[model samples]
Target: MTRFYWRKYRSLGVVTTLAILYLIVRAKNYEHKAFVFLANVHPSEPWEFVADFSNMKYLNPTIIDFNLLDESGDYVHWKYSLEYSEKLSHWPHSYNTAVAHFNIKASPKKDSYFIHSTHKTCLLFGLYCLNSVSEFKFSHGNSSKGASCEEHIQYQCPTVLSSFCRREVVYQRKAIMNNLFKKFDGRKF
Candidate 1:
């Protein structure tokens, strides 16, 4: 009887271990959002502004440090540190800083520029990983000195934290758009 009981418990232990491993290694789906706005400046202006890594701090105040790791013909690898605060339902706000790495490829056309960037970061002691892709296209607008910009962002994170990530993505994108408009148009968005 002891042998039989030992074998049954061993099987149960193996099953439990497999289930936990599956939960830890499961793949997450990406969420996407696209934003379009007009800037009262030439297409090349905003394109240049975005392509330069040093100018990021001006666009996003949360970014405290920016560094270039590598640069090839049309591709650049960089990293930046950003500080943010989060508030839970009834808990006090928590402040944290995160460093993210980016790889960007830029292409210039006759009257437009396209940029593709990949971002990666690990959060919560590396238990949760966040990956995102951002595409920016700047083209000539209806007016001579106007430019139309489209930003598309896709992000992947654990399901439990997806809502929070979505909210942050929308808020940050809108804030960037507003800042861009103010910089180029000299008016509020």
Candidate 2:
């Protein structure tokens, strides 16, 4: 009876191992692009929110701590709060903070303001293999609150080894839009 149980358990273990191996082997790099619209936000609002790393909390709620590591003209390097390692028990142990770099541009185009951002790589958070770019355009409009605007955001991620974190991107996008459209859209920053 003990031998029979042992065999059953061994087979189960082997199957689980095979499944993990299959996932690892089948993991292919991919690229994803998506767009979203934010209503009631001014044309210049999103650009101002992202111009400084100090304002990251306006977009990503999970970030508890943010520190600027380096900065230069059109480039920024920072370590933002992350919990990927804690949540992924199988992931290799490393630093808890995720380091990210971005190249940003803010442009004025007559009736709209465009903010272009490209993410190079993020280390120690399973994002080192991915490259991302985002463009935000805010169009000015008329509203009862004096001046209102719509935000159009385009997001693209390339060379993703796994789709596990794709949903996180979507969530972040929605969070940013939600924050941007909140009651306080005219506050001075």
Candidate 3:
């Protein structure tokens, strides 16, 4: 009689262990969001990565910033910001921000909205997510290697453009950087 009870208890313990493990794994899997890359380009060419705007890894906590400039070169005109954790079914469904301007002198009167978000990290990170979302509205369009990316890249204009105008300048800069950080292999963008 004791042996029988021992066998039954052992079996129950095994089953409970398995159940707990299954639940742990399931919960872990649920925390990860999978997404494919937006571009399949040669690593040597950054432009290739931006060719297809639709190809992006969805991400979480999308970064949004909108700023409007007035004629006096002042940021006093307007601003709006939106953040999203998911791209589809628009989790937190209704989010909209608006800024109004009453100034007349803003030359090229500019209002820009920028987003940096993702559902995943690494290649499926913020860069790919932003490009994908930007192109979502214009999928029925051209097939350029970096048209969409280039357009977005334009927005990321350097705080200094003249410094990047020449190839020799860039080469020299990178060579110097390599020499400076040659010991750091784990340093990634």
How accurate locally is residue 96 in candidate 3, as Cα lDDT from 0 to 100?
30
Scored by Cα lDDT, where does model 2 land?
A: 0.48
Top candidate, metric lDDT: 1
lDDT of 3 by residue, 1-189 (tens): 999999999999999999876553331111111111123222212222212122112111222333433223233222222232222123234333322222211113222112222212112243221111111111101332211111111111122322322232234224322322232221222
Candidate 1 lDDT, 77-181, residue by residue in tens: 333333332232222243233444443434434476666776665555555556677887777655555777778887776665566666666666666677777
After TM-score superposition, the amount by which residue 152's alpha carbon in candidate 3 deviates from its true location, in angstroms, is 17
Clashing pairs in 1: none
lDDT of 3 at 46: 23
lDDT of 1: 0.60
TM-score of 1: 0.67
lDDT of 2 by residue, 6-40 (tens): 99999999999998866654433344443334445
- The superposed Cα distance between candidate 1 and the true structure at residue 178, in angstroms, equals 1.2
Q: What is the C-alpha RMSD of each candidate to the true structure, in Å?
A: 5.1, 8.4, 19.5
List TM-scores for all candidates, in order. Answer: 0.67, 0.51, 0.21
C-alpha lDDT score of every prediction, in listed order: 0.60, 0.48, 0.26
Better of 1 and 2 by lDDT: 1
